[model samples]
Target chain A: MPDEAPNDPKPSAEDSPAKGPGNPAREQEPAAQAASEPEARAAEVIERERRGPSGEPVRSVTFAERKRMNRRELLKLVPLIAVGAVAIPAFRQPILNQGLRFSDWTAGALFGRHRLAQTYSDREVAPFEKFPYNFYDVADPGVDLEKWTLTVSGLVQRPGDYKMDQIQAFPKVVQNTRHVCVEGWDVIGNFGGTRASDFLRWIGADPSARFLEVTCVDGYYESIDMATVLHPQTLFCYEMYGKPLDRGHGAPLRLQMPTKLGYKQAKYLDSIKVTNVLLSDMRGYWEDQGYSWYGGL
Target chain B: MAATVAVVKQKPEETTTVVYEHPLVVRIAHWLNAVALLVMIGSGLRIFLAFPSFGPRIPQQNFFVLPPRPLTIGGWLGGALQWHFTFMWIFVGSGLLYVVYQIVTGHWRQVLFLPRDVKGLWPMARHYFLFSPKPVVDAAYNPLQKLAYTSTIFFGVVSTLTGIVMYKPAQFWWLAWPMGGYHFARSWHFFAMLGFVAFIPGHLLMVAIHGWNNFYSMITGWKREPEYLE
Candidate 1:
């Protein structure tokens, strides 16, 4: 605010001429009383009439010429009609969708590969009971934990149903990170899982794939950019608070990414596909319904 | 500012003077930014309705009476998010253009409130609220007008910065630190909106009091026989 202080008082003082109808002397000037005006005041009026607001020469014109000038100035604002298109019901949704897509693209571009989400100490983690259960459908989708296997397909060298033990075989990672919801709520909790990058490497997935699409037993689906999918903090989560994930928290396996919104951290993940293209009609569960797909924090 | 006072000859006996009060860039940015700000406020309220609190979600304390539905834009949370995300670009873009233009043209001097203007504020406020004698002002804007206009710039900066932190918290984690982290930034964003909400009614009322000629100046950049000239 201090930097905004003006340099000098000279400009304001020079502009403060008392030459308006409010001044009795100026009011009497047009009534053939020019001889009665003060010499200094008459000189000031002549100087003011010669200059424009920005010190340009002022141009005298006819009434018709002034009207034409106003019309030309008004016409230049016609381009703003594009914004008014949003008021039409038919155009609203599409326009908004495009905007969201643009935002998602920018979010993807800003995503840092090595940048890490802030990790909390054990004491900073919210209690297990404090973590709210959020799901689009039923919390318990009734996945048979013992018989469950991750079905991997699409652009992976190894494409088949893989057992839980096989995924758990990768070096386990335990960290406490914040989970942010699109609703503006957030919580920090302890999560244990293997690095998603490690699992992708193990499955020989194409590193250049543009997207990682996942489907959940609860019917929730999500598509993540390859950059976020391969981030170091991204995890194939299997446990919470030192215990295996419960039914309410996407039992067996879920995606736990500190960098993504809760909706993107899909729970009860049934299948994950490494793909270069996403289905046009179904990008994500909440996303298809109008929520931002990028859902990055 | 000195009146431009271009004489428009109507007849041999009579003439009128017009002043170019606003530049074309300023006029365009003003109207567009006005629309963008309205959309931002309406959709922002709807988005806030989803959580409606600044506290921990576990305890779930409600902040205030929920904003009535009619006052908000977009029918639901998802719908509101779309509108909010979309118009934010327009809001930021126009606001930035206005500021950069003001600075580049040295026109900010007309509106930016400075320490010297502080003494004149009480007199302007007294004139408006207490019906005191109008204080003579030399510049394009009086002290109180400058205060109100200048505050919006502050609000714009706060809202946009806090919004960026919330939008990409992880990517801009360092940005959140100065605001006491993400939670405080959200609160700051809300407060900034409150500032806008407070400003608009007074702005509209003043425009109404000034009548059509003053209002038309914003649209056409010229005021026919401006009050000061008259």
Candidate 2:
């Protein structure tokens, strides 16, 4: 801090600061001479700090003054702190309780919907006809195939722009399995149509595409990792339980995965995209706030 | 009323004292708070990462960067649930005891919240911002501290209640009903987590800025500078 040479021994003249008031000692000197003429008395006035150097007796007067001052200060600080300490616990309990509550219920609740998952005693697993159910003949709601075409895009090699027939043409494999919803529910159903793996393979799922994002006819959309999409149970089912797929059950085409929770099971499938990406500023349907993306059973 | 006579006496020098401030028990509690809060944040993140509960989610597309630890200490999700609840109770318990101790010992008023201090908040803020050395000095709990600590407590209690509502929905359905149901409880819970996330870094920075050494008094139980005790 000394602009003057480093060797400067003292506060340079320019930096000279004013000292404290003088002459107080002179007043004490007069009092000392008048009151205590004896050398021992003078010695007593020259009060050595009552707090001894290391360990020695000190006068109770000085010790008492110091002790009293400290106790007063501590006393003051204590009450002030004490006043506020009262409310702290009342506040803390609520915070902990809230955090744990929702987290506890979410996983079980969302997983409940998996019962509707397409299951086949058919396919490679078993024969569906062997179940020996009387077939209920119902007229087709007759969804126009010409007007229907599935659009798929995202981080993929060739995004799918194909028809129902086009998807049907892709070495179709259907599996009947249970659909589990994270909401603590389940459904068992039959599925017939293109497998997500076959569709992904047909599209030559891009090497970089780590997630499979599916958008439904409703504005709701869900994105899943390629691993889950490619799981043996996932399906882009076109038919359900001996009938043209009902629209209510994510008809036309829908995703049916036994392993994943219900929300991961996209319904009314419309658009598909493959990408190793996520919607940063987005939360889809149930996932808008708390639902987990994994949705694994 | 009685004096603790000084064991050591110095010859002809000014007498001064460095009084005992924080006791060992108090200091231990303080440090526990620091450690517990750290774990709470770290494990809290783990719990939150479980499903991106509440809002503002980060998509886990890159498994390599945010590798899945899955936090499966036990077989199922219940393991994490139990761990978080256990930690939460510890944190809550420590804070509860500390409050009771401070209040019983008459230290809480000085360290935490107060009525007059509430009035002094604006002046305290202005003095700090303006860099005025002549700051308002009362007995304790500067107005700013009162408000902050008070808010912290307020937030803490509300959050805990909402947490209970969400936690045992069937059990505490009555409480959640006023907040519009479990959904709102989830929303409040999310907001409270945000509050803690925001509070911690700022609290640490303030402690550092003011003086980390002074802050150490909470650990040492005594200020090194005797004049401060005065």
Candidate achieving the largest DockQ: 1
Question: How does each model score on lDDT?
Answer: 0.82, 0.53
Off by over 4 Å in 2: A1-297, B1-16, B53-82, B178-180, B226-230
lDDT of model 2, residue B111: 62
- Give the CAPRI rating of model 2: incorrect
Models 1 onward score TM values of 0.89, 0.40
**Per-candidate iRMSD:** 7.7, 15.5
Q: Write the per-residue lDDT of candidate 2 for residues B1-230, one digit (tens) a residue.
A: 01122224433333333324566556555555555555455555454454444421222221123314552221223334444554555556656777778789766665676565666677788876786564646343466666665665655666678866644443344687777754577567656656766777767777786563346446444332222112
Worst 10 residues of 1 chain A by lDDT: A1-10
Evaluated at residue B110, the lDDT of candidate 2 is: 59
Tell me candidate 1's interface RMSD: 7.7
lDDT tens readout by residue for model 1, A1-297: 001111112343244343332444533343333346432222212222223334322223335555766788889888988999999999999999999989988888888899999999999999999998875255678999999999999999999999999999999999999999889999999999989999999999999999999999988889998889999999999999999999889989999999999889998989999999988767998888888988997
Clash count of each predicted structure: 0, 69
Docking class of 1: acceptable
